[model samples]
Target: VKVFGEFEFWFALIKVVAIVAMIALGSSVIFFGFTNDWNPIGFSNLWQHGGFFPNGIGGMLLSLQMVLFAYVGIEMIGLSAGEAENPRKTIPMAIDSLAWRILIFYMGAILVILAIFPWNEVGQQGSPFVVMFERIGLREAAGIINFVVITAALSSCNAGIFSGGRLLYALSVNGYAPSPFAKLSKYGVPNRAVMATVAVCMTGVVLNYFVPDKAFQYVMAAVTFVGLMVWIAILLTQIQFRRSLTQSQVAELAYRTPWWPYSSWFALAFITLVVVLMGFHEDARIALVLGPCLLGVYLAMFYIVGLHRKTKLSREFK
Candidate 1:
């Protein structure tokens, strides 16, 4: 697992460097008048046709749910906290980097893409990355994008499985899951936990075989809300943790979530708004329905198996 983690770290670094390079190149093409054969493709399409908020506030509101899912793997940092040598410092750095990541990697790329191509034509032109490359006379644009997309997907999937397996192992150790899930492989990996996670992911693979066109959409519609719920729980837990600490202890801490309770409250309100927005959108309704039902099952099991009592007693004795 250590070796695997090292490999993932390198792979992820390469991924980020590549995307940043692309964004820089694209921004240069858009602003400088050097890339597109000295024809600066300034930001006209942004508001030329129908103004900036072309689709209006409704479209922006609808996209909020999509943005929540976009930040899915951010929580993987929490999973790695147990192994981090300087988690207090490193985690805050990581969290702060997310703002820049969203700004540079996502928004910067988006602005570059929209500057070069109209919003409506983006989908019809295939990937905007490939389009930007093609505009610069890159003959291998399609192949390059294909390779990058594959690597990106593999990296994201690897991170997800690795983090989730660790979480399952933790749950098992804490008596929330089957004891067998706590076992580790010779490589010091949570083999059973990883296998179980892979099995769950394989359900999507199976769905792809049967319903290729709609598999991703259906799965996303059902599970994205769960990701938001996880995010909200983490935020709430952070607030509670801050409350548990003395003001002196908090001031002594090197790293902390910014704005403390206000940040958590704002995030909770934003997430709740997204969930409510999900109710208004047709495709998003699936998540709203399934998300609550899933939570209900967890709550029911907590009561049925006396996990709350078990956990309370464990904490008391500890």
Candidate 2:
């Protein structure tokens, strides 16, 4: 945690600074003609081209598959609570700030980019931020954007390694994974689990090298499908946990999701809708097939490894 925590801090800071800078720069260009010629860029670019929603409602719904993919590892925030010194205080604060972060980092950035440049002109080949900066005659700023993008990728890898090792360790301790994965290093690190995760990541890299064209699409779809299932499982678990608690016990909770059943049901329905939409997409449709097959494989592993017997024994003990 210590090694990666430092890198995560710097990477997150750079991303935040970059987003804020872009927003401010875009605002200046829109409101005060801060570009090269000192001529107001105006907001006509936002609507004059395709008048927004050019792809229609179905297109927007289909895009949610990728949008959900962007949030794939966000649940790690909750998972990390188990290791926190003060989880009750830190977890709730992190959860509450999530919406604001999404609004500012994702929505704000997209809004500014679209407002500054015509939607159609934003190419698919490179980062829109780089394009925006270069268009404004700041080539050096574009180079910096590229560097930031690299750091972002590195940050993602760092997070993946951290979360993957912890999850593997949890599984090992629960008797689902191999006992070797439960072992820790002198520094209290799950070295075996971490090595396993790195091995899996390398397999992915080799697979990508073999089929570079289709690799990302396939991986994104699979990851998004798994992420959605994880979220559903979490909500259901929370609901069951709440049902097991008395009203007074619930009242004493450190954090509670607002609207209870209503919000939970709404989120479930929305995620289901996204999954259904994935079937309509060519690349994402594979996930609908792969997901069930993967689940079946896990079920087989559970029984094959005698986990069902262990579960029965635990229940008898309880």
Candidate 3:
């Protein structure tokens, strides 16, 4: 795995730079009198307009799908175990810091945005960030934010390609996908996997040119369903991985998930609730159907491709 190679390293750097720039710009606007109505817009907004649960428990519950999606990349650090300089030491250190880092970056940023603008009023005209800057009468700040969001999208796309490529490579290795996907180039990169991922992503570019509105919505729904399925798989895999371990080996886990069976169960339940919520909203309903359908297709393919037979024969021989 060319984990820290030129492409991955540059893409990560771009994301870091964009985030730091947003933070710095936001702080300057808050601290200095960089705008006309220079008010702190303190924490009080969290409760002032219809309180914290303004949208009621239903809205909050529905929002979990987006929140969980935001945290999708959290496991990327763990996936780097294969290429880490020192797996045991570095992996533990990263895991130890992961929770706090996410809380500060994801949760903290949301809090700040809510403070600056009323939660309900957000997304009324456009992005809450853009609205806040415009409220402060900083036209330039708004433009800068637009640019930042563009960079953020590019960074996200770059990461998505990288992740999808790796996933295809893994599937190939397990014989769940074609053998060509497992082939690598002289640079130690899964070139075929990279090309395949890029090709799939380019379909979006073509759709944007042809059927922009409908295509974009369909693509977004598909992506969300795919993401939800991946999360469910990960949680299920972790459960099986833990169950298969001996008691001594289980005790040796460096970064065990908290609340054990309970937390895992709760996470699964929360995901199910999100799916149920999606069914209530017309915009998200397609995802509710698509997610399970995709999973069913995967199961059918597994059986049709003789994965079970191969595994059983291998086990018998062993």
Candidate 4:
């Protein structure tokens, strides 16, 4: 896991550098249009074929479902808080950095792509990253971009395994999972939990082999739903946590979420919007239904086995 972290970090740096380069190059092309002989690469792509809102607000709304997948690993920065030596200092710094990271890496990259190519024609030309670089006459840019993308995918997989293992380890320690899953190897890795997590993930590979085309859509939607569900839980948990604290206790805290109550409320509203939008897309609706079905099973098991007592004990110990 430690080595995985190092690899993920390096690959992420590669992506950031590549994206920063793209944005810089794309900006030059847009404003100066020197590549186009000072033609002033304009918003014709945005509004020419159809207006910016060509598909209407509903189209924008539905796009959120896909967009959520892009943010799959955003929560990773804070996931290690329980084991961190200085979470109060590091966690806030991590969260604070996300604003700019999202701005430059995600939003900025999309802006460059949409501006450089017609909105509808962007995907048709191939990866905007490679296309933009190719325009600058780098034939190797496509292979490099493809390599970076492969690394990014690997990084995501590494993070997913680490997250799943840690979660099950947490549950095991709390007595919700088998006690053996909580046991760590000499290096302090939860071997049992990691193996179990990897096993579940491998099931997806097996499904893909058998189902091919249908497998990806179903799994992606399920993953998106889980991501949304986790975010909602985190927001609600934070709100409750803040509510539980006295004003003096809250003030004594080293870190606090800005805008207090409103921030939490707004997050809840935004997540609610995503859920509603999920229903608007047929493929996503599978997740909307299946998420609750899975939740119902979990709830039923929790009550049937009385995991709440163990959970309370876990919290008290923490």
**Predicted model with the maximum TM-score:** 2
Considering summed lDDT, which 10 consecutive residues are worst modelled in model 1? 309-318
Choose 1 or 3, whichever is better by lDDT: 1
- True-vs-predicted CA distance for residue 295, candidate 1, Å: 2.0
**lDDT (0 to 1) per candidate:** 0.79, 0.87, 0.72, 0.82
Per-candidate clash tally: 0, 0, 0, 0
> Model 2: per-residue lDDT, tens digit, 1-318?
888789999999998898899888887888787874788787888887768788988888999999999999998997778778899999999999999999999998988888888888876758999988887878899999999999888889889999999899878877778889988899989999999999988866876999899888988998899999999888888888988999999999999989997898898989999999999999999999989899999999999988877752222110
Error of 1 at 188 (Å): 1.8
lDDT of 1 by residue, 53-134 (tens): 7889999998887777777767887777778888888888888888888898888888888888788888686677777778
- Choose the strongest candidate by lDDT: 2
User: What is candidate 3's lDDT per residue for 188-271, written digit by digit as tens?
Assistant: 678899889999999888979897877766666566667666677788999899889998998898778888988987887776
Global Cα lDDT for candidate 2:
0.87
Candidate 4, 310: how far from true, in Å?
2.5
What is the Cα-based TM-score of model 4?
Answer: 0.92
lDDT of 4 by residue, 1-318 (tens): 677668878977988888887788788888888568877786567677787888988899898868888786678776778766899988888888889988988998888777777777776676777877777566687679878778777877788889898889888888887789988999989889999989998978997999897787778778888888889989999999999999899999888889989988998898789988888888788888989999999999988888866536466223
Worst lDDT run of 10 residues, candidate 4, spans: 309-318
Give lDDT for model 1.
Answer: 0.79
Instruction: Name the regions of candidate 4 deviating beyond 4 angstroms.
Output: 34-38, 314-318
